[model samples]
Target: MSGSNKTDFTNPSTFILLGIPGLEASHVWISIPFCTMYAIAVLGNFTILFIVKMEPSLHGPMYYFLCMLAISDLVMSMSIVPKMLSIFWFNSREIDFNACLTQMYFIHCASAMDSGIFVAMALDRYVAICDPLRHSTILTNPVVAKIGLAVLLRSGLIALPLPFLVRQWPYCRTNIIRQPYCAHMAVVKLACADTSVSSYYGLFVLFCVMGLDVIFIIVSYIQILRDIFSLPTKDARLKTFGTCGSHLCAILAFYIPGLFSSLIYRFGQNIALHFHILIGTICLLLPTMLNPIIYGVRTKQIRDRVLRLFTHKGT
Candidate 1:
């Protein structure tokens, strides 16, 4: 690429998001579902937070982690969806350089925090089921607070360098992002300078956060299942397994599509670009929408409270 073809400065003041290239004609129709999903995610997560805070019995470690997960979901969805909708509906494609980087940071940080919450949730289930005698002693209030603080610090510190790394790059190539939001790769790929450092650092962070978390979750669940099966009666086994049903649903809802979208973003060169973008979008939105619904329906305590709250309001 010649200097004549690139931007004049080392950095452009703004980047234009294309809102899923190759699907411009369907932007309006696509925004409909995206908007609906965002709305549902916001309402569902807030409802979960409110109910958890209001109910005394739900103040255990599991619900505290649930509140953290809800907060992460809200941050993740809000960081991208509003800007995405603007691009889709109003053709408001221009995002300031600083604003773009801020979006990128929040999205990745929230994702890391969400992954950590899953690990915490898994451990909570493990303690509750595998070692019921020591559950409260192990996961006391102070300990839970420390775990939450550790998660927040780890996520924020790890993601703190991303925006700075991006800002250091000379983005002279083009200012047009092909996706709906300021995805790290999408933004970094626009730089005229070498992005190998950024790419490698991103991979390092991904493995450090999500990879280790996945392994821990797998080990915890294995122990949980082993203990669950050792119970003598069939009803005992079923009851123990049922206690983990919501967490299992949440883990599946988050990790499966999230990991698939991440892999596709990195290695799916032959895949359609539009398909890739859509999958990434769904990866962020789907979990936010499904998590609260899964917990609300699967957990008896939450379900009963939700029903009672609505019934009281109707009276």
Candidate 2:
């Protein structure tokens, strides 16, 4: 390839996020609310992580999953909130391509971790409720550590290839991404490459990993409910379900919106692309804000621990 004939692929690598063009009107009105939500999401998740780490009583498998959830939420929020705030505050849509890839990596990694943690939480609940006697032996420290490592590996394997696929493409100058953050499929659609392969493969990965996790969770909970009902008393059943209600809520909050966005994009009546972006942003951001509080407050052990810490500090 002669130097003169070579494509000037080196145009100062920057991308403009078009953002939700329709919502651009709401930009000023939503800035404060967005910032408040971001702050609450980060702080809430971090608090859950801190409480779990400090409270010895919450050291079991249940809290372990909560800690994992907190970490994932924290990372997920951090991955996009700063850029989003910048977009709102400065009205600058520009994000460097490298930065975009970095954001996508963390977003996907955290999303995968979130799904994995929910599965682990469901299993933990199943064990505790269904086989209380063996819970200790089954969910041993070594097993917990191994599970954590597996979760990390699973998430990385699913998300790591995404950026590589995007980076290899020669994206033309129309770099304005339609969403608040860099989403894998959304960004890939812009790439000037045969994205059919990437799209099909990405959907395959999503369905295989996330679909399996969701199925396992459903099966675990069904067994758990049966075990709870088999017990002698209503109080006992309620107590068992009560322990997991928070986690169940978090799972619903996380999955439902995501699945809705996916369905809307795939099969809904013809809508503007920006509407998809808006739905995606809402689904992603709201869950990050709600998961920590839902999982943290519902678990009395964690709530008590957080209170005790604050009590001691005040003293």
Candidate 3:
């Protein structure tokens, strides 16, 4: 029986994607919410970019970082959702080997970039609240440009090696990935050769990027809190803290689900596969959908501008 069931493919031209293994019967129903979220994410992020671009008054360091966050959310969602919908709605599952790797690279790169942007936003808030006298000088146009460039380069370069690393290993086990989209470990687990290096490198990247960013963000906010309380008046303290409310919400929306999904994928062995896939999908899509909503509702300037635009159109 073992001999008869031997693996034949060394490196297939295409791989199959199984969208939510045990939930095959619910694929159509599942696609409904995913599609809804994807649409909202696209529209919301684009609106953010458009508003920030057109309103010169909003073109500050904080909004500049928000633009970066919006762009990353777009890239991250577009990299996965369309193909995932194809699988669920149309039953189209075949993905080219190179395409799979490319998808994996963009998904991870965008995620890393989002985390970096959050950190940038945190620092922007820190400077604005803690050292208001120099906020403008500290985060000038040139400095903001440099920071954005660093984020792009860092995320791209770190994720660039992942595909090449996975490609070096021959995949003889199977060509069917059990997730809606191509994920790093999902692909790595398919290789017939030892994947210890790939696994270790992935963990290292996670620690270096997400871990350090989390620590820095926490530290920045702690200092920000101290400075907020130091304000002489209660109204001043409330106003200062209110400025940070949207950023705090966006940070939580992005990190909590993301970290939970990552941890579950790595250690939750007893968890059902479909549940894992669902959480992972939510981890990616939820934040993309929520970031714009959080800012639109929480940030006074953005909220006013958005409402004005709609009201002007109505008139």
Tens-digit lDDT track of model 3 for 1-315:
143123666666888899999999999999999999999999999999999999999999999999999999999999999999999999998899999999999999999999999989999999999889999999999999999999999999989989999888887778889999999999998888889999999999889779999999999999999998888999999988999999999999999998899899879999999999999999988999999999999998899999999999999
TM-score of each: 0.97, 0.92, 0.97
The residue-by-residue lDDT of candidate 2 on 278-310, one tens digit each, is: 677878888889987786678777777778778
Task: Report per-prediction Cα RMSD to one decimal.
Answer: 2.0, 3.6, 2.1
lDDT of each: 0.92, 0.82, 0.92
**Displacement of the residue 177 alpha carbon in candidate 3, Å:** 0.3
Candidate 1: RMSD to truth: 2.0
Off by over 4 Å in 1: 1-5
**Candidate 3 or 2, higher lDDT:** 3
Clashing pairs in 2: none
Give every collision pair in model 3: none
Q: Tens digit of lDDT per residue, candidate 1, span 220-291?
A: 999998998899999999999999999999999999998898889779999999999999999988999999
